[model samples]
Target: MTALTLAAAQTIAIAGDVPANIQRHLAFMQAAAEHGVQLLVFPELSLTGYEPTLAAGLAIAPQDALLAPLRDRARELRLTAVVGMPIRVAPQTGVLIGALVLGADGSLAVYTKQHLHPGEDAAFIAGQGGAALEYGDNRIALAVCADFSHASHPRQAAEAGANVYAAGVLISEGGYATDSALLQGYAAEHRLLVLMANHGGPSGGWACAGRSAIWAADGGLLAAAPGIGDVLVIARHDGGQWAGHVVVL
Candidate 1:
């Protein structure tokens, strides 16, 4: 396909409800597939929601029972999906905040949040590797929540020859107003297309903003979801620019 169709869903999940979250994510993936979207992205910590209190108890190994269905869904839909979850690597080391990329063929790749906020430092470990995955003629670099706010994060992706950068985020109510502009700025400076998926409703006693958005390499906002219930935003890119309609699915 000359034009790449990308979609993101801003959905909510109660803290620690893995089954429901996976079901919701699968529903969105199915919708994206039906719409002929090549890739679908979900919010950060989407499987378990942004519940720091449950980090220790909820953390799961990368290859665990909880994620098997998601892998199957990706293969079944023949769609690339990015989902975030808290991962436990070792006992001494705390959990790591991670986003896993499931290729249409069932291949797996990952990107962890290298920078942890003050509140997350105690519960999550910072990731060191910077990686990018190629799919459907697009070099996609994946970033976790808060990673895109730093200049080095997007710069690393751009330097790695990534034309598109995607972030799975949990943007709290107050945090959205400040960080959204910064995300846009990063895209502009790096000359890369940026896509961010954020949680929609309340989770862990915190209200979240569901305004998932897509920005052109020039930093122009192509599509933005109003902060509300679950919503999907789609953006198409052609000739290194966003030149398509913003469809809500």
Candidate 2:
């Protein structure tokens, strides 16, 4: 089988700045493509930080022209990227935490957060999640910040024939221990390769704990960022083995 490269883009978002964040995302995409990464995942609300109050005003349709640059870059680099944003689907009154998938083939898909954390209901509503992403022989299930907290979420993904589980999250230091443990447990229980992308700095008044990481099917730690900053945690599956590395950008 051919090798597959995956990466977690641990980025620091400029609060409520979509244009700046897009440039940052572009930079990460370029770096990932240089490393031959086929799939890259970024933190929840990466395009607009984790500020819920700003989400409503910032929400746009999935096909908004604002994302054209990102889409073009993905097609040019032949890299598939899952980027987080605030989006409102037609007839949906409330904003949803969206993971927008930009396929290498210039296709677009959306994955909304089905589960809402406690305080989130004030700013957003739970949404019907999107479909898993299929690349080569791998099927990937996507999760926004709070979705992975529920065991049923990952279980359903595995039952649906997903071999890779990727989550875009904004985890704070206080909740890091519990959250990371849950993600790792899911990996071991489901025997699915897991990848987590987290914010590299504070956002939405929360001090984020940026230790983005990846684990093999057995829950073995493959690669992780030491702390916080703009970096990429990459895992490569080749020759029937999984290996990892980090790129500080």
Candidate 3:
């Protein structure tokens, strides 16, 4: 079996600054590549920051010119990266919260957020069904910010034979404690690897909890960020259990 090393990155996002965000992402990507990480995950809306009201204007289509360089970075580094961005599905109707997966070979897989927060419903459309992709020896199930709040999301992924449940979230300051417990419970119930990447610091007038975390199948906290600044957390699944610590570099 091919071993997979997972890296969950928490970044301080600059609101509406796509270029700066991309630069930060590239820097982390380079660092992860140098550390021999196979899969790297970032927080939801990492590219454009989580501004629900402004998402309509900032949303990018899948084929937008801005993503070309990001795609190139993934290919050049030979790393699979899950980057969150606002997606414009239609011209003016609605947008979607999406995580665009760029493979080392330049292929792309898009996972739209299945569950939208109540506040976000007015701005974005929710996706239907579940999706999974193969990465090394693991079959990864993707989740957006609010998807992990629903028991059915992780349950369905477990039922679908997913060994890894990955979530990209923009966790606000108020929601940290609740979300952490929810994630722990989800991991325990499904007996699957739970990896989460969350935005850190304040952006677009909102402050996010920087507690990006990874849990083992038994609900053990394998790695967690210190609720401040940018963090790169690495966790290893050894003998069907998650082990290792958070690396802030």
Decide which is better by TM-score, 2 or 3: 2
Pull out the clashing pairs in model 1: none
How much lDDT does each candidate structure score? 0.82, 0.95, 0.85
TM-score list, all predictions: 0.93, 0.98, 0.94
Worst 10 residues of 2 by lDDT: 87-96
| Residue 151 displacement in candidate 2 (angstroms) | 0.3
Clashes of 3: 0
After TM-score superposition, the amount by which residue 83's alpha carbon in candidate 2 deviates from its true location, in angstroms, is 0.6
Q: Using alpha carbons, what is the TM-score of model 3?
A: 0.94
Clashes of each: 0, 0, 0
Residue-by-residue lDDT tens digits, candidate 3, 92-176: 7578888988888998888899888887788888876346878667888999889988899999899988888989898888888
Stretches > 4 Å off in candidate 3: 90-93, 238-241
| TM-score of candidate 1 relative to the true fold | 0.93
Specify the poorest-scoring 10-residue window by lDDT in model 1: 240-249
**Model 1 superposed RMSD (Cα):** 1.9
CA shift of 146, model 2, Å: 0.8
lDDT by residue for model 2 over 1-249, one digit each (tens)? 347899999999999999999999999999999999999999999999999989999999999999999999999999999999999997568899999999999999999999999989999989888999887788889999899988999999999999899999999999999999999999999999999999999999999999999988999899999999999999988998889999999
